[model samples]
Target: MDSSENYRVVCERVAAAARHAGHEVTLLAVGKTQPASALRQLAALGQRAFGENYVQEALAKQRELAGLGLEWHMIGPLQSNKAREVAARFHWLQSLDRTKLVAALDRHRPADAVPLQVLIQVNIDDEASKSGCRPADIGALAEAVRAAPRLTLRGLMTIPAPHPDPRRREAAFARMRVLFDDLRRAHAGVDTLSMGMSDDFEAAIAHGATLVRLGSALFGPRR
Candidate 1:
């Protein structure tokens, strides 16, 4: 399908999933590796929420797609030096997995904007390559986040080891739910479990995910 048609189909599916999940599903068009023209087309399709893996790529889209008012999310691994730039631009940081990073985020938030929306990336599979905090450490980090002036401890996010099986994905999502609950008990106003992706997002929703980061499911497989 052409980009506009493809974007329409994806947006419809995403809205349906959101309603079905009883979640305020935020359709973060995972625009990684996608061209600015395609993204501009998609953005024209009433898509305001977008996620990009690389900081430079996101900035390019942000600049290219100017006046579209997209809410950009940094969904990939972030290094220390880039944190300041990211804090200055992106609306959401969905890949935060460590205390030091969290501290850096707090220190760097631009003073004028709303408290930045942040998510704690969880490495549910305990994989060395993936970015996320181990599930057990979230509570303490949430507390630390609460104290950060520039950040609003909005919720948790994760990239579990991918499993096509619905039940297994749900279990991983359920673990996220447990951690979410733990955070709420400790820090009030901590909501949103930003789990799930194209392959297993339905399972994540069934288990409780407020936001789903989708790429291929919406845009089709990236070549």
Candidate 2:
């Protein structure tokens, strides 16, 4: 199918999932290795949010699509060196895993811009290679984010270990939902729970994911 057809199918699936889950969910097109033109195409189809893994690539796309009013999310592991660019350019950071990054992002955020929307990525499955904080560390990291003048604590994000069993994945999502609920109770304005991707979004939504990221399912496989 073409991009528009792919978009329609994905939207229909998302709407069906949302209806089943009894809540509204947001879709973030994962534009990682895709071209800026692809993003323009999706934007023309009413996709307003896009997620990118690299700062430079997202910056270029942002420049190319300058006036579209699209929301850019940094959905990959972030380094301290690139915090300034991310703080100044991206609308949201979905991989905040440490206290150090909190300070860097807070310090570099432009005073004129709105507070950067932030999600605490939790390593729910405790994978050694993941880019999120330990589930035990959520509170401290959340406190750091809240104390930062230029960041907003928007709730949790997780990429669970891709277990072969669907039930196992749903279990991880359920755990994340508990963490998200606890976060909302402790922090005012904590509403986003970004924990789904193309393959398992329906499951994620069933467990309370307010935002799901889609790439191949929306734009076909990356070249």
Candidate 3:
């Protein structure tokens, strides 16, 4: 499928997933290595929110496409030094884990901008390589995020272990859901769960993800 045809199919799936989740879906086509034009094409296809994994790459896209009315999301591990620019530019952040990064985000939160929406990334896989706090650590972290006046604790985000066994994936997502529910119980304000990606978003939604971020599924294979 060309970009146009591919976009149609992707938009349908995104709409279905949004309906299934019973929440507003930010289809956030992940454009890590892809060019800004591809992202712009998707934005024309009605995808307003976009996610980028690399700071430099995402920053480039943001700079180039700033006129397109894009809502950029920092969906990868954000370095503490990058927090100021990330907080000032990106509207949503899904990979906030460390306290120092949070502090930096709060300190740099743009006074003229909207309260930055945040999702505490949960290390559901407990992997040594991933960039997230453990499911157990999310609660304490939530307290810290809520205290930041310029930051709004929307909910939780997680990257489950990419295992063949669906049960493992489900367990990881379920663990994140537990933390999501726990936090929601404590503060009714934190409502967004920025979970799921191309491979296992359905399971993430089944476990109660409010936002499912997709990339290849929407834009087709990256060039």
> Against the true structure, whose TM-score is highest?
2
**Over 4 Å off, model 2:** none
Output the lDDT of residue 184, model 1. 74
User: What is the C-alpha lDDT profile of model 2 across 6-26, one tens digit per residue?
Assistant: 999999999999999999999
* Cα-based TM-score, every candidate: 0.93, 0.98, 0.93
Candidate ranking under lDDT, highest first, comes to 2, 3, 1
The residue-by-residue lDDT of candidate 3 on 9-72, one tens digit each, is: 7667766866786766656678978999998887787778889998889889998888889888
Instruction: Give each model's clash number.
Output: 0, 0, 0
Between candidates 1 and 2, the TM-score winner: 2
Error of 3 at 48 (Å): 0.5
Alpha-carbon deviation at 58 in model 3, angstroms: 1.2
Model 1 TM-score, 2 decimals = 0.93
lDDT of 3 at 223: 71
- Judged by lDDT relative to the true structure, which candidate is superior, 1 or 3? 3
Angstrom error at residue 139, model 3? 1.9
Provide the lowest-lDDT 10-residue window in model 2.
100-109
On lDDT, the stronger of 2 and 3 is 2
Q: List the residue pairs that clash in candidate 1.
A: none
